[model samples]
Target: MKKLYFLIFTFSFLGYITEAQQLLRGPYQQKKTPNSMNIRWRTADSLDAKVYYGTDLNNLNLTATVSTLENDHDVELKNLSPYTKYFYKIESGGNVLSGPDTAHWFRTAPVAGTVQPIRVWATGDFGKGNDGQRLTRDAYLNYSKDKETDVWIWLGDNAYQDGADSDYQAKVFEQYYAYGDIFKFMHFYPSPGNHDYNSVCGIPCQQDPRQHKGPYYSIITAPQQGEAGGEPSTLENYYSFDYGNAHFISLNSELGSPTAAYDWIGAYTNGASTSPMIQWLKDDLSKNTQPWVIAYWHQPPYTKGSHDSDLFYEIYMKAIREKITPILEQYGVDLVVNGHSHAFERSYLLKGLTGTAATFNAQTNVVNGTSGKESLGEAYIKYTDGTKPNEGTVYVVCGNSGSDVAANKALFYNGSPHPAMFYWDGGTGVCGSFIIDIDGNKLTGRYLTSNNVVKDEFTIKKQSVTGIKNINSITSSISDAKVFPNPFAKNATLSFTLSKPMALNIELFSTDGKMSRVLSNSSFNEGEHSIEINSDALHLSKGEYIVKINEGKSASFERLFKVD
Candidate 1:
C-alpha cells in the first residue's frame, strides 16, 4: 500500500513537472453523432496520433491509437453508446499530453428523435485576436459556470490578418487556448466569413484562384456526407448537423451559390432556386424530422449597423434576404443568426414580405405585434402537432465579437433604426454573445453582454392542441392606450379609458419577469385615467420595460420606452 501511494504521487508530480511537449492547436472535436465522433489536434513535430478513453475517469483503459507519423492528429472514436459520457486523454509519443483532468470528457449526442436539454454557444466574427474576444469568452464562461456546451459554432472570420497558418496560431490557437477544454469536450463547428476568405477580397492577406481556395478552405473539416446527420451536401463550404431533436445548417453567404452577389436590383436574388447550396437546403429541410431548425452564416440578411442590409451595394445581405429567406419560410425555419455587423440586433417574429428594408411593412410582415417577450405574455407559437407550422422565424445579428479597434467601433454604430429590426444596440464598447438552450418543447435564447447583463431574452415553445389558449376569451376595457411623450426621461404617463367602472391593478415589471413596483391597486370609475410611472422608482437601465395593466382577470401589456 505504501509503494502504491508513492508511485501514484510520483507520477502526478512528474505530470506537473517536465511536461514540455507543446500542442500546436486543438484536441478540437468534430463530426459528432450518437455513436461516433472525431478528435483532432496539431503538434510542432511529426508524431503518431492516439486517444485513451473510457467510461471511468481514473481508468482510460480503452485505446484508439494510430501509428502513422504526422503533425496533424486525427482519431475517430466509434461504436459508442447513445447519450453516454466518455472520459479521454490525448497522447503522442507514448506520453499523456492533454486531459485526464476534470474538464476532459464529452457526452455523446442523444439518438435522433430523442428529446434532451442541449446548450449551444454561438459567436460571430470572433477571431479578431484581441482582449475584447477574450472578455467575450470569459463573460460567457462566467455565465455558464461549469456547464459544458454540447454544440459550439463560430460565425466565421476565425483568424485575423489573412487566414494563414501563423495567423491562426497567434490569433486563434494561442489567445483561445484557455478555452481548449471546450474544443476537447464539445463539437466545434464554424462557417467562413468574408475575412476568412480575405485573400479573395480586396485587402488580400493571401489568395488562390486555382480552386477558390483560402486558409478557411484549407483548415476546416465540415460534414459533406451526412455523417453528423443531415442531407449530404457533397461540398465542404456548406453543411448541416443534428443534435437531439434539432437540426442546424451552416452556409457560406460570402461566396454562396452564384459566387458573388452583385449590386443590381435582382442579381443573385432570383438564382437561389438554381444554386447548389439552396437546392441542398430545400432537400434538407423537406426531409427533416426534427422539431427545431436553425441556420447561421457570416453575413446577416437584415441589419443597419456596420453593414446595411437595405443598401443596394451590399448585395450579399440583400440577395440572401430576398432569395434564401423565402425558402426557409416555406419550410418553417425557427431562427436565422449571423455575424458581419458589429453589434447585437434581434428582430421581431416576421413572416413573408422580403422585398427590401423599406418594403418591410410592419403591419403585414411583423407577426404577434407585441414585443415577443413571454414574461409580458407575448411570444411566437410553433405547434409540433405534425399538421400546423404557423410560427414566424426570428433573425439575430451577433456581430459584436470582432476586434475592438477604433475603426471597428466606428464600424459598429454606422447606422440605426432599421425598419425590420425591433431591437439593436451599438456603442464604443457595447459587446456581447448569445446563448441558446433547448429543453424538450421549450427553446429559449438570451443575449449575454460584456457587462454580464442579459439585455434580451425570448422563448419559442411548442404546444399541443389542448395547450393552446384562445386570445379572444380575455376581456379588458383599456382603449386608446398610449405611452407618452413617446420616450419619457423620468416620469412616463400611461393613459387609457374604460367604458364601465372596473377594478384596476397597474404594475411595472422588468422584461425578465421581475415585478418592480405597483403603480395602482384600487377600483376606478369609468372615463379616462392617467398614471405616472417614475423611472427612478422602477430602477431600470436605459432601454425598454414592460408596463402591465390588470383589469379584473383580463390583462393588457405595453412596452415602455425609457431614455437617458
Candidate 2:
C-alpha cells in the first residue's frame, strides 16, 4: 500500500512540471529610467509572470512578479541603481524561461544632464523580415561587438504590410532575420511610421490619434510622465528622453486630427499651433538644458529619394518643412533624422530655408557649405555662446535600413541632387543605417551600410564663444599672422603684426584640444613680430596643433602642422 502511494504521488509531480508555460515573445526591455526598467514578454499559457534580477548575476536576490495570469507579461524592476548593469531572467509559474546569462543584462541611463559617452543605433523601415534586415542587423552587431548600444531607436515603419500582431511577431519578435538577436539586450524607443499606424486604423490607415489604439501601441511602452526627462507628453505617440548631455525628442508625424481634411497636416498646421504634439515640442525644447539636441520622426522634411520633397502632393514632407521646421530651428535643434524615403540622404549645415528645393539660397540657407567631414578638416562647429544660436541643423534621411531602394527610385531633385543635400546614396542601391556617438561636446554620425562599409560620415563639435568682441578687437590689432614652413621638421616661424602695443602670450594646443606648449609670454611693442615654434624645444609630436595668441581678454587661433 505504501509503494503504490509513493508511485502515484511521483507521477502527479511529474505531470505538474510538464505543464510549465512556454515563452512566446520577448524577454525584452522597454522604457528604462535611472531607478526602474520595464521588462516585457509573452508566453504560451496564462500563468503568473515573475522576474528575478539583481546587480550580481550569480545571486539574483531581487524579484518583481505579477500574479495576474495572462499570455502577455510586463514586469517592472524598480529601485535599481542609476547607470548600473543588472542581470535578469523571466519565469512563468516558477518555470525558468529565458536567462541570467551574459546577454540578459541592461544598464540604466546615466544621471540626467550628465556628460557621458553615449552610443545610439537607429533603424528605419527595417521590419521586413528578410535578409536585408538581417544583414543590416548583423553589420551593426559585427561593428559594435562588445561595445553595447546605449539606445536603440526605431525610425518607424517597424513592420511591413498590415503591421498586425501576427506581423510584429513574425517580422520583429520571432524571425532571426529581423532583430531577433537584438531583443535579449538593447532597449528600444520607437516612433510610429505610416505603416505602423496601419495596425491602428485599417487598410488605408487614416488614424485619429486621439483614439489611437492598436497592436503597435500595445507592443511598445512610451514614457508618458517625464520618466526619462522633459515634460510629460501624456501620450504614447510622442515623448522625449535625456541620455548623457544630449536631449532626444521622438515626435509622431503620423498623428493627425480626426477633424482635419488631410491626415498628415494635423501634426503641422498652416497658422495656429493647434497640434498638441507641436505644443509639447515647443514646451519641451524651451526647458532643455543639454548642450546637444537631436529630434527624430517618420516622414522627412527634405528628401529626393523614393519620394520627392518638391512635389505639392507630398503634403507630409511639405508640412514638416514649412510649418514645424521653424520651431525646431527656433530652439536650436542640432540634428533631425527621419525614415520614409528608402534611400540615404544627408544635408549640409542648414537653417531658415523652409521652402521648396528651388528656394534654397546658399547665402541665406546654408550655414556651412563644407562637407563637415572630420578627416577633411571641415567638421562643423557650434558655439556655446548666444551669438551662433539657431544657426545650423544637419538633417539625415536614414530610411533604407531594410527596404532597398529600387532602380526606378529617383535620388535627385530637378535632375540633380537637392540643393540641401551634401551627401546621398546617389542611387547606389545600398541598404544602410545611422550610428551616432556623442561624447561631451563632439557628436559623430556615420552612414554604415549592410556590408559594413562607412558610406558617409560627419562630425560636429561644440565650443564656447567667449570674449568674441575682445577677440575681434585683438584680431584687428594683429593684422597679419602666418606660420612659415608649417610642415617644419625642426622649427617654424609664427609671424604676426601688432597695430598697438600690448601684453601678448603665444601658446600651442594639440589638435585634440589640449595645450601642448607656451612659446612666449611678454609685452610686445606695436609692429611685426615673429616667434620660433621650436619642435625640439617643446618636444612636440608630429601632428597638427593650434597656435593661440592671448592679448588680455582676447584670443585668436591659427592652425600649424608638424611633420618628420
Candidate 3:
C-alpha cells in the first residue's frame, strides 16, 4: 500500500514542480471575502514569496509581494473585485515555484449576502494520512469534473491520533497538496475534534484560548471580526462566516464534551443566559439577515455511528440537542452538521426532540410535508415568514470523508443505521463527504461517495419575504405569512406575499386576543416579504400576544406566546 501510494504521489506531483526548491505544503486559501483573499504556501527553505496574479492568465499584471524570508508564506491580496476569477503563480526568491496553469487560480468570494451559486466541499474525520484520505479526495475531484469550489469545511479530527503538527503535516497539509492545487485556491473553515485536543505540551501558541491545550489552536486561522460574515468572534476556536447568501458557522463542540473533560474551552448550558459561546450563537443568529444558515462542529447531536448517541457521547451531544438545538431552531437555522462518529449519517428533517433514537417520533416531530427531495417532487421548505417557521433541521454526520468504521465493525449500535437517518451506507463502508450548493433560495446537499456517486441528494427551498419571486408561487405579487417561535421570548419575523402592490396594516392583540397596538401601517411591493416585532419594547410580560396582518379588508391572524 505504501509503495503504491508513493508511486501515485511521485507521478502526480513530480511534474508540477520544475525548480530546485522543495514545495512542502499549501498554496491553500483562507479567510476569503469579496474584496480580499488570504493565500498561503510553504517552501523547503526560508525564501521571500511573491504572488503574481491577474484576471487574465496571459497578462499577469498585478503583483503582491512579501519580502521577508519565510517558509510558511501568507500573502493577503486586498481591494480585489468580487465574484471574479483570477489566475496566479507563486514565486520564491526570484524563481517561479508553480505556474500560470489554468488550475492555478482563485475566484473572489461572491459579495457578502449576495445571492449567487456556491459549491462547498465538506469533510470530517478525514485526515488519516492514508490511502482512504487520498481516495476520498480523488472521488470529490472526479465528481467535481473541474467545477470551482468556493469554500471547504473540515469537521475536526482533521488529523489522526493526536492533532500534532506532524500529524497535520502528513494528513491535512501534505495530503491535500498532493491531491491537487485546489487547496491553494478555496477557503477552508475548520473546528477541533477529540483527537485534536491532545496536549501540545511545550507549544505555547497552540494552547487552547480557554486554558485547554491542543495543537489545533496553532494550525488554523479563522476570521476574527466578522471579516467573512456572521458575528465577530475574536476567538479562532469558533466563528461564523458568510459566502454568497449562506451564513456558515463553525462551533467548538469539543467544549461541550463530557467524555473529553480535559478539552474544555468553556461550558454552555440552557440555564445560563450568558455563556460565552451560547450568547455569541444567539447574537450571531439574531443579527444575521441571511436567508440560509448552516452550522457545523465536531460532535453530532444525534447519531448511531461509531459512537452511540443513546448510550454514550451524550455529554456534548445532549447539551447540543437540548440546550443548543432550541436556540438554532428558534432562529430557523436550516442545517446542523457535524462529524464525530466515523460514518455517513444523514437525518430526516427533525424538530423539538432530544434523547435517544427511540425519542425520534417522526409522527409529531418530523414535518411530513416540510421536507422531501426536490427530485422526488416536494423539497424541504423553510418558511421565513415567521408563521409556522419550519422547525425541522436536517442533521448530517459527515465524519466519513477519509476514515471509516472504528474498532469492531459489525458490533456497534446493533450494526445498523439509525431509523431517523436517511442515507447511511454510501460506499464499501460508508466513506464519503457532502457538497453544499446554494443558488438563490434553493440549497441542496449531495453526499458524494468515494466511487464518485451521489448516494443521497436533498434540496431545501427557503421562501423568504426578501426573495418572494425566487420561489415557486402562483403570483408575481403578495403572499401572507406569520412570524415564528410563536411563543415568543424576544422578537419575531414574519413572511408575507404581495401581488402587484398594496398597503399593509399589522396589529398586535393582548392576551385576551383583543386589538391592542398597531405595529405597522405601510405599503409593500409585490412578492414575499417579512417583518420584525420587538416584544421587549412593547413591554409585554409573560403571556400570549395576537398578531393580525390586514391587507385592506383581507386579514390573517396568528398567536404568539412570550416567556422570560
Model 2 regions lying over 4 Å from their true place = 1-21, 202-208, 261-272, 413-415, 426-429, 466-564
Question: Candidate 2 clashing pairs?
Answer: none
Tell me the whole-model lDDT of each prediction, alpha carbons only.
0.73, 0.81, 0.73
TM-score: model 3 vs. ground truth:
0.74
Which residue segments of model 3 deviate by more than 4 Å? 1-19, 175-180, 199-215, 256-273, 369-371, 406-416, 426-429, 464-564
* Preferred candidate (TM-score higher): 2 or 3: 2
Clashes of 1: 0
Tell me the TM-score of each prediction against the true structure: 0.75, 0.80, 0.74
lDDT of 1 by residue, 482-540 (tens): 56663466887988888888888887765455446788999889999899777887776
Per-residue lDDT tens digits for candidate 3, residues 94-156, read: 778777778788888777788778888889988787766777788988888778888888898
Mind sharing the TM-score for model 2?
0.80
* Number of clashing pairs per prediction, in order: 0, 0, 20
Superior by TM-score: candidate 1 or candidate 2: 2
Best by lDDT: 2
Residue-level lDDT of model 2, residues 369-474, one tens digit each, is 6677878766776655432444689999998888876655665633667889989873434688999999988999999999999989998888754323433333
